[model samples]
Target: MTEFTEPEAKLEALLGIINSSARQAIAEYKKTGHGVPSADATTFHPLDLATDTLALKKATRLLEGAYHQLSAILAPPQHTVMNFVFNYNWACTNVALRAHIADVLEQHPEGLSVDRIADAVGLDESKTARILRALSLMGCFKEVKRDVFANTRLSLILKSANNTGCYAHYHSRDVSKYAGVLYETMIDEEFSRSHEVDKAPRVFACRKEGMEESFWEMMKNDDERRDIFHRGLIGHSEMMGTSSVLHQYNWGDVSSVVDVGSGIGAFSMPLAKMFPHLRITNHDLPEVMVQARNAWEENVPEALLDGRVEFVPINFFEDIPVAGKDVYYLRHIIHNWPDAEATTILHNIRKAMGPNSVVLIPSSSTHSKNLAVAPEPMLPNFGAGSHRVYQIDLTMWFLLNSKERTLDEFKTIAAAAGLALTQVYDLVETMVIEFRIAQN
Candidate 1:
């Protein structure tokens, strides 16, 4: 029998993961009733429009992890390390979004000459072509012919009308600026070790530029950015497949749900659409209530007309939400604050609960060290497969001095708020954890 070396064992393990994950991914595509997508295909697969992608996400996570591991081990250390330093896809994508390059290209379906595209956008043709080419390498755009560019399925996301595009713009630009100051924040006298929202890297960056405002304050002051932000929340739901909670959980049994801090009804509106029988109350600050009402009226007009939904303005810190609802749903809310404020918000919601009412928080994977662990032969944190979740954790820190919690951390917070974890439903990207009042 031949003995395998440590490196050889690692390589074989990664190869096995890659083969299994790829097969699973292909199976997922085939289940959609459409054939698997081709790399050269110009359009999105039907699965792209799907709300439930748990299987696909699981498969891709493995595939991404295996391939990254294989590449790191197979490639030269200098090459692998330097790839991070040389990569600037975010900068290129930002330029494409900011220049409205994709929007302009939308008018030309076949393909537009690089000269015409640059001239229309008022940028130098040479520079614009360079940026597009860089993005094209990533399937975002296609060079149909030399010097002629066309939008791919991926490029559609860059259009101004796409909510995800708004989201991308916010992250690739504003968040990147905050991220640039991360090291400074770690060492700054005022910001170091602070969990306050005002001490976030975004705040730090703003202070240097002679402007300072809480994230909410800034949103309240700027109409355009605010619209983009709220719209992006909807995109965030879609990207994370948060609405899958509707299908995963037994929402049918619950009659009344209060959408706490429901920005533009990303979760609740869909809940109303899928199951029209449920009653929903939208709660937020007074200004956000205005926007939420407009969004509901526009996207889910029937819910308003049916008298099933009501908008209730709230300062959750000071106010107990409308009481006795069967469910108090807080999606993407708790992760925005530190332990003290998060507990306070939960406590307020707890104050509003009836004997049977539950608190539902939609979150990314819990960091509860004792909870779920990655499959064997995979990195404990999942390496490249968990790229987005970790980055999002950092983003919470940068944007609000907040962080994603482990299961244990969540339990502690819940305990502090006088609540107990009753159930946890694992979705593809977001987990919907349910809590009820503690008996003891």
Candidate 2:
């Protein structure tokens, strides 16, 4: 056995990891009976649309992590460092999404000339051509012929109808602005040390643009944006591969679930569909409750007929959820507030817990003060494998001045609410942390 303490042995170990993880990923694709996707393919592979992607995500995480580690070591340092700032894919993607470039291209699948594409989208021809070419380099759009472009599998998500595209749209349009002022916010006296909602980097950025409404207030007042934001949540779920919880968890044993701060029942809708036995309560603000009912009625009206799901309006910081639920699920909720308010939310839930009731938090582990480390010869948190997780942690900070809590931080807040951590499910991209009421 080669000792990884030496640099050469460590490099070899990473190479082995990259190889094995890649093969594992290939096997997953083959198991689907559709084989692997070609780089130049214009259509999505069957596996790309799958919901339960835990195994594939696992392999991808290691493959990405190990390969990036290897490249950083093997390649010149300047090349790697410059690549960070050189990335303008998000900007280019923003242009394509706003222009509905994919939607325009979809009508002419053979290929559309850049001039025609720009005309259809009402954009300048030369500028649009440049954007398409940049994205084509990344396989998002394909240059089928000189100055002509076609939608690739990667570009499909950018179409107006794709929910994941909505998620990308929000990030590219809104979050990118917030990110641009990260340095300014850090140095500003008012926002530098504040962790409150009003002091977030988004607030700082918006204030500079002469808009001062809080994030939720803006969402509530703007109907169009609220709709896009809700759809974006569905997109967020897909991108994170979070639906894996549907298969990974022991939902069969559970009967009732209270979806705390559940925005339009994204998680519970699928849960209710998969396990018809679950009695679900979706608790959110009064306005959101309206949207929830409409969503369920449109999507899963049968669930409502049997009384399998109920919509209850709540202000979680002050109001308590219904009593004695089998599970109080908070998906991407706790990370939206500062520690004190986060404790209040949990404490309120703790009040409604029965002896066997559990609280589940499906979150990115990147924000924790102490993440579970990877095995030897790998960067502890799986490096680039956890790229999105780390970026999400920063996103929370940018939008809400909050963060994904560390395990110790989670334990501390749970303790404050008379709850204790019982189990942790490493769902690759995000971990589902289970908490129960503390026994005195």
Q: Can you list the residue pairs that collide in candidate 2?
A: 368-406, 369-406
User: Once model 2 is optimally superposed onto the true structure by TM-score, how far is the C-alpha of residue 322 displaced, in angstroms?
Assistant: 0.9
Off by over 4 Å in 2: 367-375
- Give candidate 1's TM-score: 0.96
Worst 10 residues of 2 by lDDT: 367-376
User: Which structure among the candidates has the greatest lDDT?
Assistant: 2
TM-score against native, each model: 0.96, 0.96
Model 2 Cα lDDT, one tens digit per residue, 273-389? 999999999999888889889989998999999988999999998998999989999998999988899999999999999999999999887634334565558877889988999
C-alpha lDDT score of every prediction, in listed order? 0.87, 0.90
Candidate 1 segments exceeding 4 Å error? 1-5, 369-372
> RMSDs, each prediction?
2.1, 1.7
Give the 10-residue window scoring lowest on summed lDDT in candidate 1.
366-375
Give the per-residue lDDT digits (tens) of candidate 1, residues 319-417: 999999999999889999999999999999999999999999988774445335456567766788777777888989999999888767888999999
Error at 406, model 1, angstroms: 1.0
